[model samples]
Target: MSYPDLLSFAAGLLVTGALSGVLAGLLGIGGGGIIVPALALALAAMGYGGDVGQHVAVATSLAIIIPIGLSSARAHDAKGALDRPTFRLWAPVIFVATLAGGISAGLFPGKVLQAVLGFMAFFIAANILLPFLERLMRRVHGSATAQRLCAAVIGYLCALMGTGGGALSVPTLAAFGLPIHTAVGTGAALGVPIALAGTLGFLISGWNAEGLPPLSLGYINLPALVLIGGVASLTAPFGARLAHRLPARTLKKVFAVFLVVVGVSMLWAAFG
Candidate 1:
């Protein structure tokens, strides 16, 4: 990249990191919903291949989620909100699913990936915007088999979309009778395995692919990954602190609007 291009990329990452941190804390989201598309736009604009760019963004976003998920999970755990038993039961299947999803991501075309992410984003936003729809979502229960199935599905889907598990996990957990706080905490914790397994899969899948940018390790962009992950992790605590004082509902509504924009934009990029 040229000096100017590098500057632009850094600036974009800075903004993305800052916003992701605040949203993670303020909304109980893992922030991948915000990060993935933002990275996709930046990479594409920097002249990465149309398809490769989005895939890299997705993989890199998943990689970056490691820190944010860990931090958020720790905070929630400290608050006694994370459901450990649920996480324990769900982890193994999620590991397998994320691995499979990561591998499968390479088989699909860019358009397919974008369509998948766009639809997932739309669903996420809808759940937030329309409480009734969220309420209508199926709820699981104390059954180990049900939790395992839910985790496997969430892990697979999130891997494909480059999201942390929060978007899917929280609602599913809530449906299973976990409190919102507990669900969010559990979701954050679950993201660790999902991200790790998916990251490894993407790394292997993208290793020999053509048209990757400089400093890329497979699908992961090292510069962006390091900068965004570091910055977002640093800022998450501040966001958590702010959450104690700020109006969560207002923040979440704002996030929902942003999510809608992301979904619509990705769909346009994919099909338009």
Candidate 2:
């Protein structure tokens, strides 16, 4: 790449990381929604298109989420916002399911994964924005068996979509009767196990994949991971502070609107 292009790309990565880190702390989203799509576009623009590029994007997003999530979780915990019992209940199931999803990711088409991300984003946004849907979600609480089932699904889908699982987990936890802040805090904590297991699974599964980008270990792009992860971890605490200051209603609206944009953009990217 020319020096100008390299500079632009570097700038893009830094901006993406900053925004993603803020979202990770604010929404407990671990920055996957932003990172996965941003990395995919950046890779494609740099001539790394097609399935391998998408794989690299997802894998790298998971790798980046590890530190971001940890930072967000710590910040939330320091504020006494984390719901430890719920996190403990969900963590193991989420980790195992994410591992399974990551290991099997290569079996699915890139478009399929992208579509799943898009659709789920829309669903979560709708659940937040539409009062009836919000009411419906609230009415859907259940037993331990049911909650565990939901956690499994969240983990599996998060692995496929390269998300931190907060987009799904936050709303689900809220519906299960936790306060929104507590849910967000716990969701941030849950992201650690998901990212750790998913990263390992992707590393193992993509080890022999063809046409991977240079400086990649398996599907994870090393340069991108390091750059993004470093910047994101630094910014996450700021976001967590912001989240605490925002009202619960405003926070939900912010998350919902964010998801709407992500859902629409990702769907367009997937099928356009």
Candidate 3:
């Protein structure tokens, strides 16, 4: 990239990172729902091919989530809210499934990945916007084996979508009869394994792919990761503080609208 283009890219990353961090903190959701689609669009604008750009975007989002996930987990742990037994039961399967999903992601068509991201976003949005949908979502609370299976599915799908798994895991935990706070805390801890394993898998899978962007390590874009991660970490505390001052229901509605817009755009891009 030319110097001017490099400047533009860095600027975009900074903006994206700041927005992601704020939304994550304010909404108490993983940033990947925002990060993956934003980066994919930005990369496409920069002339990267659809499949390669989406792969890079997903991988980079996972990489960026590592530190943030760790920090959130620590915060939740400090509050004594993390469900250790649940984590111990679910982490191993989640890690394995996420790793496998990340590795296999490169083999899928770009449009498929795009559609997955879009659908997941819409699903989350519906859960938030239409309270009735929550009543309809199947509640799976059975044997330990069944819970682990839920974790595995959450991990795999999160890897494919470049999420930290909180969006899916928290609700699953709730379905398992945990309180909302405990579910959120446990979900934060679970994100750690998903991000770490997903990053490693993507790195290995894309190590030899052709036409990667400059400053890339496999599918992960190093510059984007560093820029976004650093800025996000710095901005998140501010967002968290603001979250306490806002009406959470109002915030959820606004965020749900944003997700709907993003979801529609992604699906359009995929099939357009």
Q: Write the per-residue lDDT of candidate 3 for residues 1-272, one digit (tens) a residue.
A: 68998798789889988887765554445578778888888888788867899999999999988866766666656666689999999999999999999999899878888898788778877876675434544444557988888888988898888988877776667667766566666776788899999999999999999888888999999988999888876665455555545564665576578668768977987898
TM-scores of the candidates in the order shown: 0.90, 0.96, 0.88
45-159 per-residue lDDT for model 1 (tens digits) = 8888588988998899889988987887777777787788888899899989998999889988877888887887788777766755345444434568877877888889988
Off by over 4 Å in 2: 131-142
Task: State the TM-score for model 3.
Answer: 0.88
For candidate 2, list the clashing residue pairs, or say none.
none
2 against 3, candidate with superior lDDT: 2
Name the candidate that leads on lDDT.
2
lDDT, model 1, position 179 = 66
| Cα-based RMSD of candidate 3 | 2.5
Off by over 4 Å in 3: 129-142, 241-255
